[model samples]
Target: MASENMEISLPLELHPFVIRVLDDPDLQQRLASIVEAKAFVEESLKVAAEQEIPLNAEILASTLRPDPLGLGRFTSAPLQMDNWPPIGWLPTRTVQSQDGTPAFDWVWFGPHRHSRPFFEEDVRRAEAMPFNWLFRVRTGLQALISGYGSEPEVPLKGLIFHMSRCGSTLLSQMYASVPDSLVSSEPEPLGGVIQWIRLAKVDQESAITVMRAIVAALGRDSGTGAKYHLIKAEAWNAHSIALFRNAFPSVNWVFLYRNSIEVLVSLLRQPAIHTVENLMPREMVELNDEEPRSREEFAALVVAKIGKSIITHQHLGGGLVIAYPDIIDAATTSIP
Candidate 1:
């Protein structure tokens, strides 16, 4: 087979570094090696397909795989695995296939102590899945087509939104504190769906459908007396309020924000990924019709956008608004 030099375009964020590396012959050789390895994998898979080897979901589920990030080589069956680590598990991220279909990769967690925060719990998960690539799993594509059929204990209890630096994590910790609550703080699959929806790679209808399935998948009752299923989205998810509501209209929603300066300070001390300018699409950023020139300005714009979303949603008769200071009190009284 003849090999052609493939021109790859870097994302806007990477263009500067990419330009610097463009002239490096070593980099070019490394890129070519990647291409050659990809071609080898494709040819191997093609030979397997020609031999009529089984590549269904069941087989894929049991087999070990080297390419965790690639979806094209697998069959259509959606991926599922048993014997997930003791603390329960969650999808780490979603990847799109050549056809633009999304698939999730699940990560297992170690035991989580009752009093531990989400970050600590995550640390436990990472410990359990240590150097995860060493122990691999094959995932197929049909799972989504066949429907993973993740059954929720009951329907989702509600959605949580917030401005960056607000105590949404603490709020999620409080919810997790409840013996019967299943609180998923920013599962990556939902974030992927939101991005897919915004990019028009996935339609609103399909996005809603996938969102419901994901919530259900994550909302498992496990006979553990889990009554309330709460999903805390990424802070900037305020931008997609309507899309989410469209998916689960009856699910109550709440937006949490702090004083502007306090929020600004929190962000300045440690910035969230979404606060980077041009990181999000223009429509989603909603920077008050102004382009921010600096990181601080971008953080300010994001905070303002979140506040505006909450107030706007409140006026639209959608959901409750909880201030940062009153989170505990509001949770005690307002949240049902």
Candidate 2:
């Protein structure tokens, strides 16, 4: 066991709960075990980081350490085992198995473990994929379809896209302020599935199945009889518009565009921008350059792709496209 050279603290919100749990002798023992397990996982991560492992299959397998009980119960799973791909090269999960059966279910790093078969199933489906881009598209489509057959259903509000940053979060937060509107921040898990589909050349039937699972999960959090369920996706996911259009013809689209230089600048600063490694040469060419002729030129190119997507949606007879500047202006209006 590694010596504890530093003391770790829980958040203020959990301090009281921690104290209460510690006061009980049996609970204290359990808590101690959890702490020890966590420390072991953390130390393994530290070593992995120092060694500069990519947090992919090889590193994940190497970091899998056995628990005190010698049951392979304290080790972490491969990042590929996670529902979503790792952000950059960061280790994303620390799983455990008991008697060769997975003890800890797939969980994102957080307190609230919302256990639902749909979430887990979707994660498993996504793990089969090589990447997540198409997964997101399929998930959105499935969500749209589920709402159709669901009892007391609400219409989807809109699908928003942008060319990387450019205040999409601010816009999403503003939209979330509206009553009964369920807003999901950059839902990237689906993206992983999508990427996998493209890489693995999955059949349409398999893709559809994966898509349906994700949609059902998203629908689980929606308010009963709400007017809209807004999903904001990563910027490069422009291709998903066609999938959404085919699945839900009535949904609207809000296509956001910013200066290319600004978008590139923002992407470079952030560690998680989706790359164009899987795209065609022509498509990559458009995205390859860091500079644009002008903001309007960048906006035009954005609008063109969005327009193409909109046309496809329109051909399918569904969805609306609104500009980000226009949405910002309207959001600030005083009139009801």
Best by lDDT: 1
Which candidate tops TM-score? 1
Error of 2 at 281 (Å): 13
Write model 1 residue lDDT over 1-336, tens digit each, in one string. Answer: 001121222223322322332334333232222223334334334433554543333322233233433342243312233322112334445666666756655443312222244433553344233222212222223453233453434357788888867788888888888887767777766776677677665677777776776666555444556667788888778888888888888888888878889888877887777777776676666764887788998888878877787777665455877888899898878966
Backbone clashes, each candidate: 6, 19
For model 2, residues 233-322, the per-residue Cα lDDT tens digits are 666566666555544456656666665566655544552333323233324223445444654454445434543554454554444344
- Position 10, candidate 1: lDDT: 22
Error of 1 at 182 (Å): 0.6
Pairs clashing within candidate 1: 76-141, 76-142, 77-142, 77-143, 78-142, 78-143
